[model samples]
Target chain A: MDEQRFLEYVQSGGQVETTDRMPDDYRSKLVKFIEMHGNSELMGVLPEREWILRAPTLQRKLALTAKVQDEVGHSQLIYRVVEDLGKPREQCLADLISGKSKFHNVFHYPTKTWGDVGVIAWLVDAAAIISQKALLKCSYAPYARIMKKICWEESFHILHGRDVVLTMMNGTDEQRELVQEALNRWWGPLMQFHGNPISKEDDPMYIWRIKSQGNEEARQQFLDGYVPQIWELGLTVPDPKLRKSDDGVWEYSEPDWDELKHVVTGHGPKTQERLEFRRKFLEQEAWVRSVVLAEAA
Target chain B: MSEKVQKIVEIADDELILGWRDSEWTGIAPSLEEDVAFSSIAQNEIGHARALYELAARELGTDADTLAFDRDPGEYLSAPLVEERRMDWAHTIARHFLYETADEIRLAALKDSDDAEVAGLAAKMDREEQYHRLHARMWRDRLQDEPRFVDALEELWPAAVAVLPEELRPQMSERLQLDLPSNSLLRGFERGSHSEELRPLLDEMTMVRRSVPGATW
Candidate 1:
């Protein structure tokens, strides 16, 4: 089939696997988009993994560890899908560490406290899950299949996050303060987490059906589902204009698109430190990979 | 504390500290698949620590959280082997293989303990340990010929034996085909000793807990 027929097929709910013929644009777009999702999941673990050590309770420690472990697992699953699409996982890691690729804007920031931990799991995972749930209909079959398992594990993370938040919200004034402070810090990135609202027609990812939902649509879903939960705790969101319209659309202040661009381009506060940390391990562990890869060869 | 409580704390502390070290690899392991597999092992160690701490908690009239996070660095009973944060894959895997081997000997002895509760928990823990052992063995076999991996194993072997009691060290050495109770353990961290690595770890491990004293995390 020609480009037009392939486009029509994907737009109308068709799926393609590794061996399927596709337009060059679709293949490259799919590799880049899916690889970024895998990168985001991998980087997302760093902020939370620190808290896994500092978790105040045995239960919280285990929960946080398991949650971070799941993120690593998701990255594994995602990178495998990309590898099948022709990008080796090693190439993906090299590109990520060298700052030649981008992850989600949220992961580029740092995690400050246990409060950041709860807020991330609760809100950040919620935002990610919305995007992931939409990908259940991803035009790429292998990516779509992995999204099923990824979505299932992410639901548990949201609960774990909310549980951490609720426990703090119900505790001492200091504990409550931690949650409020973390929420205040994370609200900005949370808004930007879904990406800028480029038109579906113009966004290559959407045009190819790799992402079944528009960026704005996902943000609206996150607000519609979570703002009430945030409000119920008597916690305030940072935005003054965040509210629901009479027509049921959620409205909020415009996100800093420039900030999003800058951060995703590798200038975020913790990006260098985080990337260096990963590179250190990768270089240190290069021998192990060589041993294993040599055997495979 | 009774001898029983001390012994439980000893093992629990090892698992707690080791798990904390292992988790440092959450996203950065050599391969993504290995990353996930290794992380589960890390989580399992923490889980084992929690269970063992609960048993100790009941005896001490406190709680698992208190035993796990509230203790000072010097108070922890973990061996020196697990105290250091070795992230190198060869060293980490070497430590993993050695630690699991030593733990098998230790757990086996506990299975026949006079205390039924301890023995029962040991049996339960052993069932779960099968996967950890298999994982360690699988990596050992794969990396046996790698020079760095071999160096790591040789360097860490003595430390691994030190993790067991003097009485059990013989059994561990016999299983690994190394000399028993060799004076050459990279350095011995007997049960009562604390490594330089533990304090920095405890500080990070308890930072949030310490920040909001008497509050929920």
Candidate 2:
């Protein structure tokens, strides 16, 4: 099929398999888009993993550990999909370490407190799940199939995060402050989490069916779904403009496009440290990989 | 603490500390499948420790969180094997395989104890230990001929012997398919033999709760 026909097919919700032939440009775009997602999931683990050790209670500890486990699991599934699409997992990891690839803007920031834990799970993951759920219908079958599992696992994280927030909210005043402080710091990143809005017709990810929803649509969905939950607990968002208009569109302070560009391009506060941490672990374990992978089982 | 409560505390500390060490590998293992499988084993070890702590908490008239976090670092009972932070995969796998082997002998002895509570708990723990053994063995097989694996096992073997009761030493040697250590087993790993690492881990782990002490969370 010609480029026009292939575009029509994807726009009409046609699914593509790995074996199916596609245009060079389409394939390249899919690889770039999906590789970034895999990178995000992998980087996302670094922040949350700390909380696994610091969880205040048994149930919270178990839930946080399991939730972090799911994030790693999602990364595994995502990388496998990318590998099947022609890029190897090692190559993906190498590019991530070299800062040659970008992940979501939010992961670059530090997770500072128990409150940050609750905010990340409740708001940050809520934002992510919106985009991930849209990808459940991704044109590439392998990537889409993994989304089903990733989205389901992420649901647990949302509940765990909200539980953390709500419990802290109902506790002592000091506890409540933790949640609010985290919210204040995180709201901007969360607002920018879905990336700057682009029209569906113009976004290449949308046209190629790698993303079934546009940037603005994903952000709005996050707002519509999570804003009430946030406000009901009496926590205020940093942005006064963050509200839904009568027409059902969210009108928020426009996210800092330049900031998103800057952070995701490897200049965020904690990017280098986190990547270096991953690099150190990989380096330390290189012997194990060399031994096991080389062995003829 | 009462004698019974003290025994519970000893084993509970060992399990909890080792579980914490195991969990350090959750995301970054050498392979994706190994990462997931290893995580489950880590979670189970922590789960087992939680269960054991809950039982001990009842006797001590406290809750699991209090038992897990409120203890002084000097009060922990983990063996030196679990306490040493083996971040490298070679050492990690060596400790994993060695500990699982040693634990099989200890759990087997507990499985037949005169105290029904101890026996019942041991039986439950043994079931989970089965998966831990499978996972440890898988790594052992994968890394059998590698020089690093061999060196790690040799370096860690002495501590591995120290993990089990003295009476069970022979059984552990048999289970691991290696000769017993020529030197006497290192002792003094029970409650109150805390690792220096526990102090820091506890400080970070308890920081949130301590910040708002007595709060519901």
Backbone clashes in model 2, listed as residue pairs: none
Question: Model 2: how far is B216 from its true place, Å?
Answer: 2.4
Which pairs of residues collide in model 1? Answer: none
- CA lDDT, every prediction? 0.89, 0.83
User: Runs in model 2 with CA error above 4 Å?
Assistant: B2-4, B177-192
Residues A1-297 of candidate 2 have per-residue lDDT tens digits of 888998899889998899998888988998898889988988998898887778887677778778877887888888888888899998998999989998999999998899999989988898899999999999888889888988888888898889999999999888889899999988888888877777898888888988988888888788888888888998888887777788988888877889888999999999999999988888777777777767755
- Model 1 ranges off by over 4 Å: B181-188
Worst 10 residues of 2 chain B by lDDT: B184-193
> Which lDDT tens digits does candidate 1 get at residues A97-212?
99998899999888887889989999999999999999999999999998999999999999999999999999998888889999998899899889898887888899899999
State interface RMSD in Å for all models. Answer: 1.2, 1.4
